[model samples]
Target: MFMRKNQIKCVSKAVLVIIILLFSNELLAQNQRVNSKSNNYFWDNVQFGGGIGLGFGSGYTDISLTPSAIYNFNEYVSLGLGAQYSYVSQKNYYNSHLYGGSLIALFNPIREIQLSAELEELRVNINPNDPSLTSEQFWNTGLFLGAGYRTANVTIGVRYNILQDDNKNVYSDAFMPFVRVYF
Candidate 1:
Protein backbone atom coordinates (compact mmCIF):
# COMPACT_ATOMS: atom_id res chain seq x y z
CA MET A 1 0.00 0.00 0.00
CA PHE A 2 1.16 3.54 -0.76
CA MET A 3 0.26 6.72 1.06
CA ARG A 4 -0.09 10.15 -0.54
CA LYS A 5 1.82 13.12 0.79
CA ASN A 6 -1.18 14.58 2.51
CA GLN A 7 -1.97 11.24 4.09
CA ILE A 8 1.55 10.98 5.42
CA LYS A 9 1.41 14.49 6.77
CA CYS A 10 -1.82 13.76 8.57
CA VAL A 11 -0.50 10.53 10.06
CA SER A 12 2.68 12.18 11.21
CA LYS A 13 0.74 14.99 12.86
CA ALA A 14 -1.47 12.53 14.65
CA VAL A 15 1.55 10.63 15.92
CA LEU A 16 3.17 13.79 17.14
CA VAL A 17 0.08 14.86 19.03
CA ILE A 18 -0.16 11.46 20.69
CA ILE A 19 3.45 11.58 21.77
CA ILE A 20 3.08 15.05 23.23
CA LEU A 21 0.05 14.04 25.20
CA LEU A 22 1.80 11.01 26.64
CA PHE A 23 4.93 12.93 27.56
CA SER A 24 2.98 15.74 29.23
CA ASN A 25 1.18 13.21 31.40
CA GLU A 26 4.50 11.96 32.69
CA LEU A 27 5.72 15.48 33.36
CA LEU A 28 2.55 16.34 35.27
CA ALA A 29 3.10 13.39 37.60
CA GLN A 30 6.21 15.11 38.96
CA ASN A 31 3.96 17.52 40.80
CA GLN A 32 3.11 14.71 43.19
CA ARG A 33 6.57 15.04 44.68
CA VAL A 34 5.78 18.47 46.07
CA ASN A 35 5.05 18.69 49.78
CA SER A 36 1.46 19.57 50.40
CA LYS A 37 2.18 20.94 53.87
CA SER A 38 4.06 24.04 52.72
CA ASN A 39 2.77 26.18 49.91
CA ASN A 40 5.70 28.49 50.47
CA TYR A 41 8.10 25.83 49.38
CA PHE A 42 6.39 25.60 46.03
CA TRP A 43 6.35 29.34 45.51
CA ASP A 44 9.96 29.68 46.60
CA ASN A 45 11.12 27.19 43.98
CA VAL A 46 9.25 28.76 41.07
CA GLN A 47 10.85 31.03 38.49
CA PHE A 48 9.16 33.05 35.73
CA GLY A 49 10.51 34.33 32.44
CA GLY A 50 10.12 34.31 28.66
CA GLY A 51 10.74 36.37 25.55
CA ILE A 52 9.26 39.19 23.50
CA GLY A 53 10.10 39.99 19.90
CA LEU A 54 9.30 42.77 17.45
CA GLY A 55 10.48 43.57 13.97
CA PHE A 56 9.43 45.90 11.16
CA GLY A 57 10.81 46.76 7.79
CA SER A 58 9.73 48.57 4.66
CA GLY A 59 6.95 46.12 3.92
CA TYR A 60 7.05 43.57 6.66
CA THR A 61 6.23 43.25 10.33
CA ASP A 62 6.68 40.54 12.92
CA ILE A 63 5.81 40.24 16.57
CA SER A 64 5.98 37.49 19.17
CA LEU A 65 5.37 37.04 22.88
CA THR A 66 6.21 34.07 25.00
CA PRO A 67 5.76 33.69 28.75
CA SER A 68 6.78 30.76 30.84
CA ALA A 69 7.13 29.51 34.40
CA ILE A 70 9.24 26.75 35.85
CA TYR A 71 9.40 24.84 39.10
CA ASN A 72 12.85 23.96 40.35
CA PHE A 73 12.89 20.44 41.68
CA ASN A 74 16.37 20.99 43.01
CA GLU A 75 19.49 23.03 42.37
CA TYR A 76 20.25 20.99 39.27
CA VAL A 77 16.94 20.28 37.58
CA SER A 78 13.84 22.19 36.55
CA LEU A 79 10.71 21.65 34.45
CA GLY A 80 8.38 24.21 32.97
CA LEU A 81 5.58 25.12 30.57
CA GLY A 82 5.39 27.96 28.07
CA ALA A 83 2.93 29.69 25.78
CA GLN A 84 3.63 31.32 22.41
CA TYR A 85 1.94 33.80 20.09
CA SER A 86 3.32 35.25 16.89
CA TYR A 87 2.08 37.39 14.00
CA VAL A 88 3.82 38.03 10.70
CA SER A 89 2.82 40.08 7.69
CA GLN A 90 4.32 41.00 4.37
CA LYS A 91 2.52 43.70 2.40
CA ASN A 92 1.07 42.40 -0.89
CA TYR A 93 2.01 38.85 0.10
CA TYR A 94 0.54 36.98 3.03
CA ASN A 95 -0.16 37.25 6.74
CA SER A 96 0.38 34.51 9.27
CA HIS A 97 -0.34 33.81 12.91
CA LEU A 98 0.91 31.09 15.21
CA TYR A 99 -0.24 29.98 18.63
CA GLY A 100 1.38 27.26 20.61
CA GLY A 101 2.45 25.68 23.89
CA SER A 102 5.65 24.02 24.99
CA LEU A 103 7.19 21.81 27.62
CA ILE A 104 10.76 22.50 28.68
CA ALA A 105 13.32 20.83 30.88
CA LEU A 106 16.54 22.37 32.13
CA PHE A 107 19.58 20.75 33.62
CA ASN A 108 22.56 22.41 35.20
CA PRO A 109 25.60 20.20 35.51
CA ILE A 110 27.55 23.01 37.16
CA ARG A 111 26.74 26.58 38.09
CA GLU A 112 27.66 28.04 34.71
CA ILE A 113 26.50 25.46 32.18
CA GLN A 114 22.90 24.77 31.32
CA LEU A 115 21.42 22.12 29.06
CA SER A 116 17.86 22.12 27.83
CA ALA A 117 15.26 20.19 25.90
CA GLU A 118 12.06 21.80 24.69
CA LEU A 119 9.08 20.39 22.86
CA GLU A 120 6.66 22.74 21.17
CA GLU A 121 3.44 22.39 19.22
CA LEU A 122 1.98 25.23 17.21
CA ARG A 123 -1.05 25.87 15.05
CA VAL A 124 -0.22 27.98 12.04
CA ASN A 125 -2.59 29.97 9.86
CA ILE A 126 -1.55 31.60 6.62
CA ASN A 127 -3.73 33.88 4.57
CA PRO A 128 -2.72 35.02 1.13
CA ASN A 129 -3.75 38.39 -0.18
CA ASP A 130 -4.48 37.13 -3.69
CA PRO A 131 -7.88 35.60 -4.03
CA SER A 132 -6.50 32.97 -6.35
CA LEU A 133 -4.25 31.58 -3.66
CA THR A 134 -5.83 29.40 -1.04
CA SER A 135 -5.30 29.86 2.68
CA GLU A 136 -3.38 27.25 4.64
CA GLN A 137 -3.54 25.94 8.17
CA PHE A 138 -1.57 23.25 9.89
CA TRP A 139 0.11 22.07 13.04
CA ASN A 140 3.86 22.19 13.53
CA THR A 141 5.92 20.41 16.17
CA GLY A 142 9.52 20.95 17.17
CA LEU A 143 11.93 19.21 19.53
CA PHE A 144 14.92 21.35 20.37
CA LEU A 145 18.09 20.36 22.20
CA GLY A 146 20.37 23.08 23.41
CA ALA A 147 23.24 24.06 25.69
CA GLY A 148 24.12 27.46 27.07
CA TYR A 149 26.47 29.51 29.19
CA ARG A 150 24.72 30.80 32.27
CA THR A 151 25.49 33.78 34.47
CA ALA A 152 23.20 34.92 37.25
CA ASN A 153 19.71 34.63 35.80
CA VAL A 154 20.64 34.82 32.14
CA THR A 155 21.74 32.21 29.63
CA ILE A 156 22.93 32.56 26.06
CA GLY A 157 22.98 29.60 23.73
CA VAL A 158 21.94 27.93 20.55
CA ARG A 159 19.45 25.16 19.92
CA TYR A 160 18.77 22.75 17.06
CA ASN A 161 15.34 21.52 16.18
CA ILE A 162 15.57 17.82 15.56
CA LEU A 163 12.08 17.68 14.10
CA GLN A 164 12.18 20.68 11.79
CA ASP A 165 10.87 20.34 8.24
CA ASP A 166 11.72 23.23 6.02
CA ASN A 167 8.40 23.23 4.21
CA LYS A 168 6.12 22.66 7.19
CA ASN A 169 7.96 24.09 10.19
CA VAL A 170 7.62 27.74 11.18
CA TYR A 171 11.31 28.38 11.77
CA SER A 172 13.38 29.24 8.77
CA ASP A 173 16.19 27.03 9.94
CA ALA A 174 16.94 24.19 12.32
CA PHE A 175 19.49 26.10 14.39
CA MET A 176 18.43 29.10 16.46
CA PRO A 177 20.32 31.27 18.92
CA PHE A 178 18.56 32.23 22.10
CA VAL A 179 18.86 34.44 25.16
CA ARG A 180 16.98 33.24 28.22
CA VAL A 181 16.44 34.92 31.58
CA TYR A 182 14.68 33.80 34.71
CA PHE A 183 13.85 35.51 37.98
Candidate 2:
Protein backbone atom coordinates (compact mmCIF):
# COMPACT_ATOMS: atom_id res chain seq x y z
CA MET A 1 0.00 0.00 0.00
CA PHE A 2 2.82 2.35 0.83
CA MET A 3 4.51 1.56 -2.44
CA ARG A 4 1.35 2.30 -4.39
CA LYS A 5 1.01 5.63 -2.69
CA ASN A 6 4.59 6.51 -3.50
CA GLN A 7 4.04 5.57 -7.15
CA ILE A 8 1.01 7.75 -7.35
CA LYS A 9 2.90 10.63 -5.84
CA CYS A 10 5.71 10.20 -8.31
CA VAL A 11 3.35 10.14 -11.27
CA SER A 12 1.55 13.22 -10.04
CA LYS A 13 4.82 15.08 -9.60
CA ALA A 14 5.96 14.16 -13.08
CA VAL A 15 2.76 15.43 -14.63
CA LEU A 16 3.03 18.66 -12.68
CA VAL A 17 6.58 19.23 -13.81
CA ILE A 18 5.66 18.67 -17.44
CA ILE A 19 2.77 21.09 -17.19
CA ILE A 20 4.96 23.72 -15.61
CA LEU A 21 7.64 23.47 -18.25
CA LEU A 22 5.18 23.61 -21.13
CA PHE A 23 3.24 26.44 -19.54
CA SER A 24 6.34 28.51 -19.05
CA ASN A 25 7.23 28.10 -22.70
CA GLU A 26 3.75 29.20 -23.66
CA LEU A 27 3.98 32.24 -21.42
CA LEU A 28 7.11 33.36 -23.22
CA ALA A 29 5.42 33.02 -26.57
CA GLN A 30 2.35 34.82 -25.23
CA ASN A 31 4.47 37.73 -24.14
CA GLN A 32 5.82 38.10 -27.68
CA ARG A 33 2.35 37.76 -29.28
CA VAL A 34 0.56 40.08 -26.90
CA ASN A 35 1.18 43.12 -29.02
CA SER A 36 0.13 41.46 -32.29
CA LYS A 37 -3.26 40.09 -31.34
CA SER A 38 -6.29 42.29 -31.02
CA ASN A 39 -8.71 42.07 -28.10
CA ASN A 40 -12.06 41.47 -29.74
CA TYR A 41 -15.58 41.89 -28.39
CA PHE A 42 -16.87 39.59 -25.67
CA TRP A 43 -19.04 37.67 -28.12
CA ASP A 44 -16.02 37.00 -30.23
CA ASN A 45 -14.35 35.27 -27.30
CA VAL A 46 -17.02 32.56 -27.09
CA GLN A 47 -16.14 29.09 -28.27
CA PHE A 48 -18.33 26.13 -29.06
CA GLY A 49 -17.36 22.46 -29.37
CA GLY A 50 -18.47 18.92 -28.82
CA GLY A 51 -17.78 15.29 -29.64
CA ILE A 52 -19.98 12.40 -30.74
CA GLY A 53 -19.25 8.75 -31.37
CA LEU A 54 -21.07 5.61 -32.37
CA GLY A 55 -20.12 1.96 -32.41
CA PHE A 56 -21.96 -1.11 -33.54
CA GLY A 57 -21.08 -4.80 -33.57
CA SER A 58 -22.68 -8.21 -33.65
CA GLY A 59 -23.36 -8.20 -29.93
CA TYR A 60 -23.18 -4.58 -28.96
CA THR A 61 -23.81 -0.98 -29.89
CA ASP A 62 -22.70 2.22 -28.18
CA ILE A 63 -23.32 5.90 -28.75
CA SER A 64 -22.26 9.09 -27.01
CA LEU A 65 -22.52 12.85 -27.39
CA THR A 66 -21.04 15.80 -25.57
CA PRO A 67 -21.62 19.44 -26.35
CA SER A 68 -20.03 22.46 -24.70
CA ALA A 69 -19.54 26.16 -24.96
CA ILE A 70 -17.00 28.39 -23.29
CA TYR A 71 -16.63 32.09 -22.78
CA ASN A 72 -13.18 33.53 -22.46
CA PHE A 73 -13.15 35.99 -19.58
CA ASN A 74 -9.72 37.14 -20.65
CA GLU A 75 -6.56 35.88 -22.25
CA TYR A 76 -5.88 33.94 -19.08
CA VAL A 77 -9.18 32.45 -18.01
CA SER A 78 -12.34 30.83 -19.38
CA LEU A 79 -15.44 29.02 -18.15
CA GLY A 80 -17.61 26.39 -19.79
CA LEU A 81 -20.41 23.88 -19.37
CA GLY A 82 -21.55 20.91 -21.35
CA ALA A 83 -23.88 17.95 -21.46
CA GLN A 84 -23.06 14.28 -22.00
CA TYR A 85 -25.18 11.34 -23.01
CA SER A 86 -24.33 7.78 -23.83
CA TYR A 87 -26.10 4.53 -24.50
CA VAL A 88 -24.93 0.94 -24.70
CA SER A 89 -26.83 -2.13 -25.76
CA GLN A 90 -25.85 -5.76 -26.09
CA LYS A 91 -27.79 -8.05 -28.45
CA ASN A 92 -29.70 -9.75 -25.71
CA TYR A 93 -28.50 -9.32 -22.18
CA TYR A 94 -26.83 -6.02 -21.46
CA ASN A 95 -28.17 -2.52 -21.60
CA SER A 96 -27.11 0.74 -20.05
CA HIS A 97 -27.44 4.51 -20.35
CA LEU A 98 -25.66 7.54 -18.99
CA TYR A 99 -26.47 11.24 -19.00
CA GLY A 100 -24.76 14.11 -17.32
CA GLY A 101 -23.47 17.67 -17.26
CA SER A 102 -20.10 19.18 -16.51
CA LEU A 103 -18.59 22.53 -15.69
CA ILE A 104 -14.99 23.48 -16.31
CA ALA A 105 -12.62 26.32 -15.59
CA LEU A 106 -9.60 26.81 -17.81
CA PHE A 107 -6.46 28.85 -17.61
CA ASN A 108 -4.72 29.58 -20.87
CA PRO A 109 -1.24 31.01 -20.74
CA ILE A 110 -1.09 31.07 -24.52
CA ARG A 111 -3.04 30.10 -27.60
CA GLU A 112 -1.76 26.54 -27.66
CA ILE A 113 -1.79 25.54 -24.03
CA GLN A 114 -4.49 25.29 -21.36
CA LEU A 115 -4.73 23.98 -17.83
CA SER A 116 -8.21 22.91 -16.74
CA ALA A 117 -10.33 21.35 -14.04
CA GLU A 118 -13.83 19.97 -14.40
CA LEU A 119 -16.66 18.74 -12.21
CA GLU A 120 -19.23 16.40 -13.66
CA GLU A 121 -22.36 14.75 -12.36
CA LEU A 122 -23.92 11.81 -14.11
CA ARG A 123 -26.70 9.31 -13.64
CA VAL A 124 -26.21 5.84 -15.00
CA ASN A 125 -28.61 2.98 -15.45
CA ILE A 126 -27.66 -0.66 -15.96
CA ASN A 127 -30.06 -3.48 -16.53
CA PRO A 128 -29.37 -6.91 -15.13
CA ASN A 129 -29.33 -10.06 -17.22
CA ASP A 130 -32.47 -11.22 -15.52
CA PRO A 131 -35.47 -9.73 -17.25
CA SER A 132 -37.34 -9.54 -13.98
CA LEU A 133 -34.91 -7.12 -12.43
CA THR A 134 -35.55 -3.41 -12.55
CA SER A 135 -33.05 -0.85 -13.83
CA GLU A 136 -31.34 1.05 -11.06
CA GLN A 137 -29.96 4.57 -11.39
CA PHE A 138 -26.53 5.24 -9.99
CA TRP A 139 -25.32 8.78 -9.51
CA ASN A 140 -21.66 9.47 -9.92
CA THR A 141 -19.41 12.49 -9.68
CA GLY A 142 -16.12 12.90 -11.50
CA LEU A 143 -13.53 15.57 -10.88
CA PHE A 144 -10.83 15.78 -13.52
CA LEU A 145 -7.75 17.93 -13.92
CA GLY A 146 -5.34 18.12 -16.82
CA ALA A 147 -3.45 20.13 -19.37
CA GLY A 148 -3.97 20.23 -23.12
CA TYR A 149 -2.14 21.31 -26.24
CA ARG A 150 -3.94 22.90 -29.14
CA THR A 151 -3.29 22.72 -32.85
CA ALA A 152 -5.45 25.21 -34.69
CA ASN A 153 -8.91 24.68 -33.22
CA VAL A 154 -8.35 21.19 -31.88
CA THR A 155 -7.12 20.41 -28.40
CA ILE A 156 -5.87 17.07 -27.15
CA GLY A 157 -5.24 16.21 -23.55
CA VAL A 158 -4.93 13.53 -20.91
CA ARG A 159 -7.17 13.63 -17.87
CA TYR A 160 -7.29 11.75 -14.58
CA ASN A 161 -10.67 11.01 -13.06
CA ILE A 162 -10.54 11.47 -9.31
CA LEU A 163 -13.76 9.63 -8.48
CA GLN A 164 -13.81 6.66 -10.78
CA ASP A 165 -14.89 3.30 -9.37
CA ASP A 166 -13.95 0.15 -11.27
CA ASN A 167 -16.85 -1.90 -9.98
CA LYS A 168 -19.58 0.73 -10.21
CA ASN A 169 -18.66 2.92 -13.17
CA VAL A 170 -18.71 2.72 -16.94
CA TYR A 171 -15.34 4.34 -17.49
CA SER A 172 -12.58 1.78 -17.74
CA ASP A 173 -9.75 3.74 -16.22
CA ALA A 174 -8.84 6.64 -13.99
CA PHE A 175 -6.76 8.10 -16.81
CA MET A 176 -8.12 8.90 -20.27
CA PRO A 177 -7.28 11.01 -23.29
CA PHE A 178 -9.57 13.62 -24.83
CA VAL A 179 -9.89 15.52 -28.08
CA ARG A 180 -11.93 18.66 -28.63
CA VAL A 181 -12.62 20.80 -31.64
CA TYR A 182 -13.70 24.41 -31.27
CA PHE A 183 -15.60 26.83 -33.43
Candidate 3:
Protein backbone atom coordinates (compact mmCIF):
# COMPACT_ATOMS: atom_id res chain seq x y z
CA MET A 1 0.00 0.00 0.00
CA PHE A 2 1.02 3.62 -0.49
CA MET A 3 1.01 4.26 3.24
CA ARG A 4 3.33 1.34 3.82
CA LYS A 5 5.82 2.72 1.30
CA ASN A 6 5.77 6.10 2.98
CA GLN A 7 6.34 4.51 6.36
CA ILE A 8 9.33 2.64 5.06
CA LYS A 9 10.82 5.81 3.70
CA CYS A 10 10.37 7.55 7.00
CA VAL A 11 12.08 4.77 8.90
CA SER A 12 14.97 4.76 6.44
CA LYS A 13 15.45 8.48 6.83
CA ALA A 14 15.42 8.20 10.61
CA VAL A 15 18.08 5.51 10.55
CA LEU A 16 20.25 7.68 8.34
CA VAL A 17 19.93 10.57 10.76
CA ILE A 18 21.00 8.39 13.67
CA ILE A 19 24.03 7.14 11.78
CA ILE A 20 25.09 10.63 10.81
CA LEU A 21 24.75 11.84 14.38
CA LEU A 22 26.94 9.02 15.66
CA PHE A 23 29.61 9.83 13.08
CA SER A 24 29.43 13.51 13.94
CA ASN A 25 29.88 12.74 17.62
CA GLU A 26 33.14 11.02 16.83
CA LEU A 27 34.29 13.93 14.71
CA LEU A 28 33.40 16.39 17.45
CA ALA A 29 35.56 14.48 19.91
CA GLN A 30 38.46 14.60 17.47
CA ASN A 31 38.04 18.27 16.56
CA GLN A 32 38.10 19.35 20.19
CA ARG A 33 41.58 17.94 20.63
CA VAL A 34 42.82 19.47 17.38
CA ASN A 35 42.29 23.03 18.62
CA SER A 36 43.44 23.36 22.20
CA LYS A 37 43.31 27.14 22.33
CA SER A 38 39.59 27.11 21.48
CA ASN A 39 37.98 24.58 23.77
CA ASN A 40 34.61 24.98 22.11
CA TYR A 41 35.87 25.20 18.55
CA PHE A 42 33.72 22.38 17.22
CA TRP A 43 30.57 23.60 18.86
CA ASP A 44 31.45 27.15 17.85
CA ASN A 45 31.46 26.13 14.20
CA VAL A 46 27.91 24.76 14.38
CA GLN A 47 25.02 27.01 13.48
CA PHE A 48 21.30 26.59 13.97
CA GLY A 49 18.48 28.37 12.17
CA GLY A 50 15.39 27.80 10.13
CA GLY A 51 12.45 29.47 8.42
CA ILE A 52 8.77 30.12 8.99
CA GLY A 53 6.21 31.54 6.59
CA LEU A 54 2.54 32.27 6.30
CA GLY A 55 0.54 33.48 3.33
CA PHE A 56 -3.12 34.28 3.03
CA GLY A 57 -5.23 35.71 0.29
CA SER A 58 -8.82 35.64 -0.81
CA GLY A 59 -9.96 32.02 -0.32
CA TYR A 60 -6.41 30.72 0.10
CA THR A 61 -3.94 30.14 2.88
CA ASP A 62 -0.50 28.59 3.41
CA ILE A 63 1.79 27.94 6.37
CA SER A 64 5.26 26.46 6.62
CA LEU A 65 7.89 25.69 9.23
CA THR A 66 11.40 24.42 8.68
CA PRO A 67 14.18 23.82 11.23
CA SER A 68 17.76 23.18 10.22
CA ALA A 69 21.35 23.01 11.42
CA ILE A 70 24.79 23.04 9.84
CA TYR A 71 28.41 22.43 10.80
CA ASN A 72 31.20 24.28 9.10
CA PHE A 73 33.92 21.79 8.14
CA ASN A 74 36.07 24.77 7.35
CA GLU A 75 35.74 28.22 5.77
CA TYR A 76 35.08 26.71 2.35
CA VAL A 77 32.60 23.91 3.07
CA SER A 78 29.67 22.96 5.27
CA LEU A 79 27.06 20.21 5.46
CA GLY A 80 23.64 20.32 7.05
CA LEU A 81 20.22 18.77 7.48
CA GLY A 82 16.75 20.29 7.43
CA ALA A 83 13.19 19.26 8.14
CA GLN A 84 10.10 20.82 6.54
CA TYR A 85 6.38 20.83 7.13
CA SER A 86 3.67 22.80 5.39
CA TYR A 87 -0.05 23.05 5.02
CA VAL A 88 -1.94 24.68 2.15
CA SER A 89 -5.57 25.21 1.32
CA GLN A 90 -7.55 26.86 -1.39
CA LYS A 91 -11.24 27.19 -0.78
CA ASN A 92 -13.33 25.02 -3.14
CA TYR A 93 -10.12 23.42 -4.41
CA TYR A 94 -8.17 21.18 -2.04
CA ASN A 95 -6.27 20.98 1.22
CA SER A 96 -2.82 19.46 1.36
CA HIS A 97 -0.05 18.58 3.80
CA LEU A 98 3.63 18.15 2.97
CA TYR A 99 6.51 17.02 5.17
CA GLY A 100 10.08 16.31 4.20
CA GLY A 101 13.78 16.20 5.03
CA SER A 102 16.83 17.43 3.18
CA LEU A 103 20.57 17.20 3.10
CA ILE A 104 22.44 20.31 2.00
CA ALA A 105 26.04 21.01 1.13
CA LEU A 106 27.43 24.50 0.76
CA PHE A 107 30.66 25.86 -0.61
CA ASN A 108 32.11 29.33 -0.23
CA PRO A 109 34.48 30.26 -3.02
CA ILE A 110 35.01 33.73 -1.59
CA ARG A 111 33.88 35.66 1.44
CA GLU A 112 30.91 37.00 -0.49
CA ILE A 113 29.97 34.12 -2.77
CA GLN A 114 28.31 30.80 -1.95
CA LEU A 115 27.22 27.76 -3.94
CA SER A 116 25.06 24.89 -2.76
CA ALA A 117 23.48 21.56 -3.61
CA GLU A 118 20.54 20.07 -1.77
CA LEU A 119 18.68 16.77 -1.99
CA GLU A 120 15.18 16.67 -0.61
CA GLU A 121 12.43 14.08 -0.33
CA LEU A 122 8.88 14.79 0.72
CA ARG A 123 5.56 13.05 1.26
CA VAL A 124 2.49 14.88 -0.03
CA ASN A 125 -1.09 14.27 1.00
CA ILE A 126 -4.07 15.94 -0.61
CA ASN A 127 -7.74 15.86 0.20
CA PRO A 128 -10.40 17.37 -1.99
CA ASN A 129 -13.79 18.52 -0.83
CA ASP A 130 -15.43 17.68 -4.12
CA PRO A 131 -16.82 14.18 -4.22
CA SER A 132 -15.87 13.78 -7.85
CA LEU A 133 -12.17 14.16 -7.12
CA THR A 134 -10.28 11.42 -5.37
CA SER A 135 -7.80 11.97 -2.55
CA GLU A 136 -4.14 11.44 -3.35
CA GLN A 137 -0.85 10.79 -1.65
CA PHE A 138 2.67 10.33 -2.98
CA TRP A 139 6.34 11.09 -2.59
CA ASN A 140 8.25 13.82 -4.37
CA THR A 141 11.94 14.42 -4.76
CA GLY A 142 13.97 17.52 -5.60
CA LEU A 143 17.61 18.19 -6.27
CA PHE A 144 18.49 21.85 -6.25
CA LEU A 145 21.66 23.63 -7.27
CA GLY A 146 22.14 27.25 -6.33
CA ALA A 147 24.44 30.22 -5.99
CA GLY A 148 24.14 33.22 -3.74
CA TYR A 149 25.63 36.32 -2.20
CA ARG A 150 26.62 36.10 1.43
CA THR A 151 27.01 38.68 4.18
CA ALA A 152 27.79 37.55 7.70
CA ASN A 153 25.25 34.84 8.56
CA VAL A 154 22.87 35.41 5.67
CA THR A 155 22.79 34.26 2.08
CA ILE A 156 20.36 35.39 -0.63
CA GLY A 157 20.14 33.62 -3.93
CA VAL A 158 18.19 31.60 -6.47
CA ARG A 159 18.12 27.83 -6.94
CA TYR A 160 17.03 25.56 -9.77
CA ASN A 161 15.49 22.16 -9.17
CA ILE A 162 17.07 19.68 -11.53
CA LEU A 163 14.56 16.92 -10.79
CA GLN A 164 11.44 18.92 -11.46
CA ASP A 165 9.35 17.45 -14.23
CA ASP A 166 5.75 16.92 -15.25
CA ASN A 167 5.16 14.89 -12.14
CA LYS A 168 3.75 16.55 -9.04
CA ASN A 169 6.52 18.21 -7.01
CA VAL A 170 6.80 20.34 -3.91
CA TYR A 171 7.82 23.30 -6.06
CA SER A 172 5.50 24.37 -8.83
CA ASP A 173 8.37 25.89 -10.71
CA ALA A 174 11.90 24.71 -11.32
CA PHE A 175 13.45 28.00 -10.28
CA MET A 176 12.98 29.66 -6.91
CA PRO A 177 14.69 32.44 -4.98
CA PHE A 178 15.76 31.90 -1.37
CA VAL A 179 17.21 33.57 1.68
CA ARG A 180 19.15 31.59 4.32
CA VAL A 181 20.49 32.71 7.67
CA TYR A 182 22.23 31.00 10.60
CA PHE A 183 23.47 31.96 14.03
Best by lDDT: 1
The sequence of per-residue lDDT tens digits that candidate 3 reaches over residues 129-164 is 898999999999999999999999999999999999
- What is candidate 3's TM-score against the reference? 0.78
Q: Where does candidate 1 stray beyond 4 Å?
A: 1-37
Candidate 2 lDDT over 1-183, as tens digits, reads 999999999999999999999999999999767644544455689999989989999999999999999998887898999999999998778788999999988888888997889999999998867788887788988899878997777889988898888887777898989887779
Candidate 1 per-residue lDDT, tens place, 87-164, comes to: 999999999999999999999999999999999999999999999999999999999999999999999999999998
TM-score of 1: 0.79
lDDT, candidates in the order shown: 0.95, 0.88, 0.93
Separately for all candidates shown, the number of backbone clashes (residues 3 or more apart, or on different chains) is: 0, 0, 0
* Candidate 2 collision pairs: none
Best candidate according to TM-score: 1
Ranking by lDDT: 1, 3, 2
Which runs in model 2 stand beyond 4 Å of their true positions?
Answer: 1-40
Q: Give the Å shift of residue 14 in candidate 1.
A: 69
Q: What CA root-mean-square deviation does each model show from the true structure? A: 22.1, 22.8, 20.3
Model 3 bad stretches (over 4 Å): 1-39
